[model samples]
Target: MIRLLRLLFWILIGRPLVLIVLGLNVRNLKNLPLQGPAIVVANHNSHLDTFVLMTLFPLSRLHRLRPVAAADYFLKNRVLAWFTLNIVNMIPLDRTKVGKRGEDPLENCGKALAAGEILLVYPEGTRGATDSLAKFKGGVARLKEQFPEMPVVPVYMQGLSRALPKGEIALVPVVVDVFIGEPVAWAGNRQAFTQALQDSVTALAAAAPHPTWK
Candidate 1:
């Protein structure tokens, strides 16, 4: 019930509102995976990444999507905390602190996938200052190694940084484009797969249109 309502509210109201008010324009929706359990790995440009994905995907079906977020930042403030956990269904990930056994974020991601849920992980640990994509972390590779069967979908978002710039509140009206790339398969070597995954994500982002004017 909650999932359905959330999905309807997002698509019917939330997405339209953001689209019209913020001038958001998602170019390639067909590229996004509509079914199955897989990793929706995207480039980290701004905090808008989560909201954009949540808006783009079906909320009811997306109930199983666990967006892996940094515990320190998202869980710190009360507003961002509530928004991330309840609104976006983000899973808190300890990016800075190390847990017992030196567990990595991929372990938690694997658990989510094992439970039949899709994961949204930013290859870049933190948001970038510019629209250019950053170097991906090894967590994505680890997650692939843990779940070789799960497909990793590469995604690129344009003009998000201008729409909602880092350390800013006022949303500037801009056409944000989301490009979903094809699913990448795990070859053989774990290390090689990780590098390939990162490279693929970077290449996808490079292909997508960047913000020319805010």
Candidate 2:
């Protein structure tokens, strides 16, 4: 029942809103992983980032795509927790209390990957200013450390901040550009790998056409 609801929500609302209402200009769509046990890393700018990334894949693969989100924010309320966990298919990570009480912050993430699910992660840890890339956190690198062979796909998005900037509820009609770069291989160390991932995203952002709007 939950799966059906999720499919219906994305098919009827999410896809149309993203693809039609707010146009997407995607390049190198082939770089995205068609299967799971992979990580899709991106620079964070707005809440729409997750929705846009998820829409890139077919609805048939919806169940296999899990966006790693902040547990405090998404699970703050019962209703939202239910919706996000069931409908959005999010894997929540408690950012504030990492490793507390013998809990592994990446436990759920690791489990998801072990189950052959693709993780959509915003390495920035949080949204940043419009049209700017912030320093990435080490969580993504650590996750990759566990599954060293798993491909880490880098993607960059523009115009999403203007469309649905942080702290705003309504979305403006802006054409979002998505650039998918080739997978960034492990650089033999977490620090190096994280830097490489950031570089890949930065390069993609550089390739994107500048937004015409302010």
Candidate that scores best on TM-score: 2
Model 1 TM: 0.84
Pairing residues by index, what is the TM-score of model 2? 0.95
lDDT per residue (tens digit) for residues 1-214 in model 2: 9999999999999999899999999999999998879999987888889889999999989999999999999999999999899988999988867757876889899999999999999988888887567888888888898998899999989989899989999989999999999999889899998999998888887777883222
Candidate 2 deviant stretches above 4 angstroms:
99-101, 211-214
lDDT of 1 by residue, 51-152 (tens): 777677765566787889889988999997876776677789886554456556456667788888878888777887674556666776667777777788
- lDDT value for model 2: 0.90
Clashes of each: 0, 0
Please give the range of 10 consecutive residues that has the lowest summed lDDT in model 1: 205-214
lDDT of each: 0.73, 0.90
Superposed model 1: Cα runs more than 4 Å off: 1-13, 97-102, 210-214
